[model samples]
Target: MFNDGSHGFSAQVSTSGFNRRRFLGGGAAAAAAAVVGPALLAACGSNAAPGSAPAAAPADDGAPATGILRVSNWPLYIADGFVAEFQKASGLTVDYREDYNDDEEWFSKTREPLSRHQSIGCDLVIPSETIAARLHRLGWLNDIRESRWPNKKNLQPGLLNANIDPGRKFTAPYMSGMVGIAYNRAATGRDITKIDDLWDPAFKGKVSMLSDVQDSLGMVMLSQGNSPETPTSETVQKAADVVREQQEAGQIRRFTGNDYASDLAAGNIAVAQAYSGDIVQLQKDNPDLEFIIPESGGTLTMQSMVIPYTAENQKAAEAWIDYVYDRPNYAKLVVFTRYIPVLTDMTDDLNKLDPSAAANPLINPPQSTLDRVKQWPALSDEQTKEFASTYAAITGG
Candidate 1:
């Protein structure tokens, strides 16, 4: 789930691997996923009214017995004892697998089964918003029945009823972050503010963009006064052209995954397209590294949870969603992962766990920063292929 188009777990985690101590100590970016376009997930939780108290699960009303609850998510993305807590509370065998590493890869494994309405082995799976959107469109996911998710009331307003899964009937956010710019202050010798700063001659060949289209081209789109939120092939092509010009002119050093972090920290690159969570973690090692949501705007993204159509443990799956959404439970995640929690009021609680993590602007950006962020729009399969090809070509992948 944390795997963006350009980076994988190896790139996102520390060199020491998924060591809990090092992870909590601030490892790689560890963000859940990338951006979605305008209203991409706008109505995802459409069934639930924002701020409404959660309702009891069907188990309370004598729902059928459930078997083991199988959940697949990104490695090390959640808190240490998250699975244990859920198991203890629900008294259900929880089979949690952190094998979901890439959107495209996971989709390939489950697509055929899901398309045929067959079980995909896991009861619940977390995928990036784009994958979730595609699954919902194919009728492969289950709706998150609100009556069993009383904690739904706490989801930040912006994430509720997202357009991708309106009424959140088919999906719910697992974790979210922003796409922006990260720069080496020492390398640039100046503060960077807007997207245009990336194109400055002083930083030529010292700047990098993401290899993913939703990130690199999306930001480029914003800088060019185009909206990725409602992208057509034409709009996306235009954005791709902008990046091509830079690549051809040798303005950009290279398109990268999270490996760009090492270069930026080492002053190998002065400016790079980056993610909010990654910058926050990177700053623990180098205070000189700064992340900015360009004044023109940035992109907001999330990795989401969805149940397979053939899932046999719907109650347990929904129960897990409710459990995580509970303020205190969610706060544990905020402290451990250092990613922005969708439940907005947990800052006070998070402060107790890690003061620095609680106050970091990159982890908890202000409303002003959020206001300038956009999501990637939904793309048809043909459009997605076209966009992917364009991005690959420009990056020389």
Candidate 2:
């Protein structure tokens, strides 16, 4: 699965028969749009615009359960066989489609219909954190907390009370990834373990940072002993100042999306702010490449499943969420996703399924690393602009 445009990394395995670069293309394009997409939507006075009055929550009409459920997710996001098993166990047919390729594109296509309180033809959709927050603010999603999903307790304790969904009323995390330093050990000639290491004079002009404001700035904030989970405009500006200083001093070679992976692999750059899963994939070709959650900390990004307010099969959608939250079932998913699993107590189950995956730190990070990872808070539109404008001026985006 390609995450929110800002973090474009392929989660698909090679055997899945999908072209990684092809998926990267859509993701890259979306990343470019993400820089300005939200502002543009607000300017156009779109009903789904961020900060607009949230649409009224849909009332439960005591409607009968729809026998069929529709889910739209990023391509190659889910493991096979589980869907078949889910159908057999729940007695509900699933119309699952992997058409959610880009966040900006999906929003553009569904906004008009969703604004009119009409279904986007999906009972469930998987969107990255930023997009999920936008939908929640627009009141376009149903509150799953009202459903009978007992497995909601399986959610990682750290993930509870997300800034976007205070009680996870609207969304459930599908999978997660960390944004941190990825380095070519041969180029660095040593291990890169902390966020400030990117500023070392030895690696000047051989380092890259993500172009996404939240990601790049989040990591920088951590290095300053600040937490991104509760950022203020002042802290964001402080972080952006660091980035500008690094860029002007020739410490940062460039700002990039997932393309940083290629540069790191070919020895064009020694270190980069990179996605965890991308490094997992790159390690296949270059064992020297290593991804680390900076000792200071790193940002966590989640692709979450949500039911649109107008979905027709609410009951079936809740069933699917429950089914996947089951530890044994989620372990099967981690083998395919190769990203961090969202459920707690998953290590033993995952080890039983794919011992290699369970052993990979990128897939199942140690407790110390998890302790340092934090999610960027849900920024209001004004707060977003304050952060984006300053960061954009420095990056020339």
Candidate 3:
């Protein structure tokens, strides 16, 4: 079950070296299910070494069933046909809803629903990186059960070390990517490589940005040489100043929650601020839409597959989680979305799935560019609030 990688996805490195970083599952996790054993899942398969799905395993129903796993996400994040495939393969119906608008919206929903044990009414959900840390800290999520996810080993080290889910104990890496800008090459005669470019006269009333506090402000701070790792008091104030200025200058055409894509596509904005994955599909559909990182830096993030504490179908949910990372599936996703795959070894499988997709730099970047990107630190609640207020004033929102 995959959507060619969209919504929020990214990779992260850590103080520690590779190998210790943990990968909890591979695509088609059924292949790795045997290693995790039934304790982590329903335990209907024989324990062979690993690497193959159990034949006639209880998890593979291959027909639609009655129960549902309400999957919540940002609207139009994943490609079509995935829910159908997962339902067809596992025989479980999906009450898939696009309720996650932004970090704050999803965080609010989870806190209220999970606090009363109302389940957020969704068993599996995807949350952006910074919020993932918050969800894990708030104790609203489930713990990682390696046995339930036999394919965990295939995950890349960068994903393994994300502080958001530290060790990914509560969730699996859904998709890993960056947040940057997308523009129409024909409209913005200048190539956009720096943050100041968004304010260029050419993009006046033609630039768009995310409606979130973390990324919008974080990008501004990075452009000013600030690491989002822990925004100092002065740095925080400076970021707010930048947002206020941008809004006052009429530089931003509009701030968006999810409609950022539509605005960019309709030519409402010539240069668009966006997540690399979000604009990937738009680029394919509209050749004029091209994306670039700001000259200073970009905000790196990871969105993950988390099983809420109130999940009713943990067994089936675990089985399906594995399906997202299996080698073949992982390879398939890299092509459709054009976001770099966190798993390095996927080149072969990716080529097999689609040669042209593999060649797209947006899908698989050259090693040099990947090295320059960095993950922003999760700001404390105070920081988030301060930035949001500052940005609202700047964007006149």
Candidate 4:
């Protein structure tokens, strides 16, 4: 079930053994006990194989109301149990489906189809930078022009200038974060604060990666000196060496999906390679679980929503994309999903919704700290395959 890197670094993807049928059958009242914990259940939804989702339901009523807007995303991407409200406001029933567990799945389904400017069968989709750029190149995007969504101007400054969709022109930032450490301070009996910390011998068998190649190894490259902005294949190769060596030394305990939240909350791991937003929700119950942007440098990353060429409900899709940026609503999502708000106004909102933002370096990192972070370059198809293989070899997946 795992890809052993006999030839080169590879990725091993499999089921997490969490019961999805039981969760769905349990319904809302039993929702709190659904899976892992709030940190994960609220952040990651259940997974299924990649395939076409059912035809979107018709908008209610005889007259043509808003059409069903099919949106594909990682599990629990939208606010939990708020579909009814979204349907009411827009008159569009969201045929929301969770077919993708990670960006790689998104790329597999959307990259080629979108590159050819063909329909990928979703109205709204979220993708990491590499695929977002490819979508822009293929002209698969319908413009989220400033005239249409003025609130975009308020997105956080760091994301405002990302290279993948520079100026945020092609894709509106859905949620952006760095791949770094989420540690159990109480269990580790140490303050974890750097990318280099993942390699510490004392923490051997207590670490898990993102179950991704880029973010996993890209963070290592950032620590060694490289990013999408200054992509040096040589540096990347060296970074791969770090993973290979670390794995050989038994530093990595497992390669995990969002499931790490359960392990960290249960004190099964002292530290984990984590996304920024997920940790915010994790801290709600386990207040001591903290995230850090390693001093050795970490990747600056963003996920975005793009209106695809095949959208069935373009207007509804555009409306929903803009809704993700509304100050009050977005603040609520930040609390539920643990993603940092792109709007500057969110700082005050975070103070009110989750005051830890004032002291949480991961969400409100100082200007100087953000300056040190690097991002991975959008790869060409040949390069993506090569780099993916390089990363696979390192981790032995």
Candidate 5:
């Protein structure tokens, strides 16, 4: 259930039993090399196995929606009581499963079934934006009719029309976290304020960057005054050069995933490219470890909810989405998950529930910080390959 190198959607992803630091020790390079491949991506846009007819979307069999609404999400993501409360409100059963860990792993397991137009045996699933974009392109998800969900009005205006799922017709905002520098105060001997701090000679050979190409490279690009919103060969190369120079100079100890949290917490590394949610949790044990969104900018990584093309219970899926967006329920989720809340209106209530969370810039960054937060653009096959290959080379994959 550890999502260390999996890609940051939130801080809650890096934790004890599923520490990213532990996963990195096994084989950081090997893991990065195989995170995604051409063979798996080939399954993306096909609706059925080759030579077979594309499977039809599941029909809405209007029998009073009674069966369990199956949901696949990351491990330990949801709040303790939300499921039971949701069940009570809707009079439907929930078969929520934490079967999704690594994005590639989930895609591999379900691709053939989805490609063959067969059910992956779930009504709703959470996939990071990058993977979700693949599912969207493959025409494998239900068009989330926003008009039906009254609570959709409560969503932050910016998220309503994502770059990948314009108008959010196929995806709904679930959870999000910022990617930035997390450093142990005692180790760094000073507060780290920007992405450039990772290169400080004093902390050389005691720093780590995420192995995830997008998080590491994208953040670097922002530091150099480039925007990932309209990425190109030149901008990406600029970012790659920065990473390579540090690696070659021995300033970077290793390319990490969520495992950076473990190293930073143990005082093994001074500064690490870290996720906001993970550092929030880590601080409970070691207050000296601070997560910062650089003064210049940072990336806002997100995981969104979507209904697979093969799912039959579309109504139930929509109901669940609407149910969670309701302010009261969402407040509970924000307090429990410790990720950035998409409901802009719930800030006051959340502050009342957990003042510390509201105060933490990582969880609830100020207006200026939010303005600088940027989401990764949806990449085509060529762009994806280029960035991945470039990053893999630096990691020695």
Candidate 6:
């Protein structure tokens, strides 16, 4: 799955030839089945409420630097040559492992050790925002702000103080993807601009939505002028009701994972809820395919880089984060991952690297699109179970 080159190394990491953004978006159904019930609740057993002040981070030991940093991140998320470049620049050896395939699996593996205030053998890990929030609440993550990370100022203005990591005390965004609409223009014979277009009678039985509860239902809620960032039981139920109506009337063809890309490319379906990164790759093969963040709105999900509380190489980990935040280095990462860069200033540097990627709206989204996409709220375990159960009923899981 990996190709080694003279200058650097690249990996065809995923079996489906996509990255973790697509993997999580497509496998969301199975993830929900595996993580949304008792396992999730057990992991979120902290008494602190969401948005409350997180418990004080563990005190930093004055131990000498280990000079070795270990990171566990999702597969194929970084640029080729980055490891070697960082090592050369900082004189640190990085033991980078792409083993963070699933959030729940990682959480399950580390819970026992972390709950005992022990190391899980890695200095840093990257997990989706929700999981990072859970780790913060559990006090399992170190406060990155305490590290010597000057480039933290380069973060996009909107990401500065997210609800999950207010002031980014615990985590920083690594990469992100938007959940939006993708359509085959040859099949639709027109443009698809809004979420409501998917429900139009003209495209009945030729429309497919993602099996991911937050993504599919969030779009429906956006169509009705509701924001998923502040979802309530009433709004969630309303969205679920619309989904049920569409399914029963045959207005919706099916609920899908990553397989929707194949169907859409082959003209088996006209429209599908898709991740932005997936569309970037799909459009290379099918010129007729187009992706858009709906005029009404869409959802944006992010994976974050965090330091474990028990890390032995906190200084080295901080240096690594700072190294990637440099504009030129971050541009290379954006090009390699084909995901949204978390920096406010990237287009110029990205254009210098790859002009084509700099122009792709999916990769370098304009301000208008950025204003319209919202991140889903950090739902409590009970809230998650309720929403997932309702969505399962509609999707007939």
Best by lDDT: 2
Report every candidate's CA lDDT: 0.71, 0.78, 0.61, 0.62, 0.75, 0.77
Tens digit of lDDT per residue, candidate 1, span 184-251?
Answer: 99999999998789889999899998876777777778888888878877888888887888888889
lDDT of 4 by residue, 240-272 (tens): 787777778888887765568778877878889
The lDDT, on a scale of 0 to 1, for candidate 4 is: 0.62
Ranking of all candidate structures by their TM-score, best first? 6, 2, 5, 1, 4, 3
Residue ranges of candidate 2 with Cα displaced over 4 Å: 1-11, 14-66
Query: lDDT per residue, candidate 2, 238-354, as tens digits?
Result: 988888889999999998866776689888899998888778877876899998888888888778889888888778888899889999999998988787899998889988998
Off by over 4 Å in 6: 1-19, 22-66
The better-scoring model by TM-score among 4 and 5 is 5
Query: Which residue pairs in candidate 2 collide?
Result: none
Instruction: Say which prediction, candidate 5 or candidate 6, comes out ahead on lDDT.
Output: 6
Listed in order, each prediction's TM-score against the native is 0.83, 0.88, 0.69, 0.70, 0.86, 0.89
lDDT of 6 by residue, 49-77 (tens): 33445444445565534588998988777
Error of 1 at 253 (Å): 0.6
Better of 3 and 6 by lDDT: 6
RMSD of each candidate? 8.0, 4.6, 12.6, 11.8, 4.9, 3.8
Give the Cα-based TM-score of candidate 2 against the true structure. 0.88
Backbone atom clashes (below 3 Å) for every candidate: 32, 0, 26, 13, 5, 0
| Highest-scoring model, TM-score | 6
